[model samples]
Target: MILHFLGSRGCIDQRSSRHWRHSAMMITQGRERILVDCGEDWLDELDSLRPDAVILTHAHPDHTGGLERGAPCPVWATPGCWQSLDALPVAERRLLHPGQPTAVAALQLTPCPLAHSVRAPAVGLLLDEGAHRIFYSPDVAELSDPATTLRDVSLYIGDGASFDASLLRVENGNLCGHAPIPSQLDWCAAACVKRALFTHCGEEIVSGSHEEMNKRLENLGKERGIEAALAFDGLEVKF
Candidate 1:
């Protein structure tokens, strides 16, 4: 599986005036594409790829901007996410309830409920193809033990949105409806995740730099005896 970050910031999409990079994420699940969140003006991101499906964990504007465009495709969302989209006229919101398994692009999808400000039933998706299982939860508030949720997986791509983001609110420069960095680390201790990636970053992160976040995570891991990785816009991983 290949995942490309089309937009990684939490609140808005901005271009690096100097570097000129975008903040959208594009995940190519074995050639077929699945867009995680469509925040900001991403006309190019949507029109460019013939996405097989669009998955929305919640209905935050930054997470569902593309739905406003009304792309002629199936939009898979939690019942809350569907409600969030129902506000839109063109969006044909389909149901993606937590704890239920479904199929998309030849991949089996299992959604796990998560905690967040919205309390709108955030989900952790477990994408499987026979033997490979990829557990993904991009935005969350706090994580419980692994037994009832993400316990074992080949890869865990979650709301590592930023190093210290979950602490602050979105309007106050936080990651909005998600957990703080330390909370996630505590949660990972129970899950045997081969690899962990951070996405849904904030604008401050762009200025602080991914390298700084990596160093912080490395230090945190060493201090706590665990490892985690920062999710970049163009990061790719193989299972």
Candidate 2:
């Protein structure tokens, strides 16, 4: 499996050379290419990626705005996501159910519901490529099924909205905003996930000193018995 982070910036005013664009990713396996998330920053330029299909994590403008112009390939999204994307001119729309594995590009993708914006509702994905397994959620407040969803996963890519401080809020009985990096690391540790990468960077991540953040993340990872790192645009991971 091969993965590329097309964008890593979160919904914040901050933008740097390393964390400029909103979160988006491209996964390629065999001859198939799947693009995930198409934030507002990408709205004017969707033709460059040339994806065979597009998969959405949620309907937030930061994750779905780029599709306003329609896509060249099929688009897959959860029912909730479709509710927000219904007006978009995507060429094709397919349903992907939570807890149900959907086949795409010879890989199995299982959506795991998460605690996030009630209006936009989000889902973390479990990508299984037979030889490799990964769970990725660029924005999450809490995961519904951590144990089952993260079991034996090789890599865990998650929200980077905050590092040590809590940026979460409870609204109308649903958790919203991003969980701190420390909290997510604990989840990874409990699930026995050995490596983790964070994207969708918030102000702290985009403005903080990379050296200091790396040290802090390294220390946190050491305590959790896992390897933790931040992801930037154009970053690639292959396994």
Candidate 3:
């Protein structure tokens, strides 16, 4: 399977050439095209994208605002996500259960619950074809079951909200917000995942010097014995 990053910026006002658009990813295998998220930046570009289906991680505006006008094909999301999008004019809505693998053409997607937002709860996806496995979660605070979710994963695409400082907060006794890059790298190392790429970039990445940040990420990965880098718009990876 081939993965393409459509956007990399987080829900921040700051924008750079590398992280200009909101977070989104397009996965393709053979003739099947599946869009991961359709943020506001892609509201008017759906026709051009022409995806066979759209699978959402959550109902955050930065992730789902583009579907305000409705989608061209079937939309698959969790029950919580569908509830938040109930008022939208979606033509087809498919329910996705966490931990249950769903087949979309040649790929299998398993949604794993994540500790992110209380209002708009999110899930990280475990994408598996027969030969390759990838874990994608652009906005994440904590994973409920990292061992099970990350098992045999070859690549991990995680949040880039912060590089080292934790953005975690306790709201109504639940953890919310993004996890730092260092913490995510630890997860990758523990899971034995060799390659990792971070997206959903926050101010630290979008506003800071790219050269310094890249060096920091490289050094951090080396310490943990993993390969890591930052993801950018239009970046493509095959696995």
Candidate 4:
């Protein structure tokens, strides 16, 4: 399985060479391609992308705004995401039941519910291709079940909204917003995940020096006993 990062910037005005566009990832296995999210940055570029299928993590504009003009292929999302995207012109809509693994483009995807936005609601995806497993959650306040969701996962791709300070806020008593990188590293360490990469970069990462941030991330990962780094646009990883 190969992972291609199309964009890494979060929903913010700050932009750098590495994190210029909105967060999105493309997973490819041979000729089959599955796009994880299509943000506003990719609105006019979908035709060229020509993905076999698109899997959305949530309905936030940064995650689903590209489908405003409709999609060329099937679009998959959780029930809650569908509710928020009902007005969109997406032709083929597929339902992703939480915790139920579904095969798309030869990859098994399991949607694990997450606490991020109260209005939009979100889920982290568990991607498996028999030999390797990866957990991807670009925006998350907390995972519903980190232990179960990350079990046997070799790589964890998570939110980079903040490095150490929590971005969470109490919204009607429910947590909302992205979790800090340090906390996510703690989760990875708890799950024994050895490799981790963070995308959906916030202002802290986008406006800071990449070299400095890389060193900080490496040091933070060392403290947690995990190897970690920041993911950049156009970066590709194979497993």
Listed in order, each prediction's TM-score against the native is: 0.83, 0.97, 0.97, 0.98
Please list the C-alpha lDDT of all candidates, in the order they appear.
0.63, 0.89, 0.91, 0.92
Least accurate 10 contiguous residues by lDDT in model 2? 99-108
Leading candidate by TM-score: 4
lDDT of 4 by residue, 136-232 (tens): 9999998766777799999999999999777899899999999999989888988899999999999999999999998999999999889999999
**Against the true structure, candidate 4 has what lDDT?**
0.92
* Candidate 3 lDDT, 183-229, residue by residue in tens: 88888887888889999999989998888888889899999998899
- Rank order by lDDT, top first? 4, 3, 2, 1
Alpha carbon deviation, residue 190, candidate 1 (Å): 1.6
lDDT of 2 by residue, 37-79 (tens): 9999998778988988889999999999899889988889999
Model 2 TM-score is 0.97
Candidate 1 vs candidate 4: the lDDT winner is 4
> What lDDT does candidate 3 reach at residue 206?
94
> Which portions of model 4 miss their true places by more than 4 Å?
none
Candidate RMSDs in Å, in order, are 3.9, 1.1, 1.0, 0.9
Candidates sorted on TM-score, descending: 4, 3, 2, 1
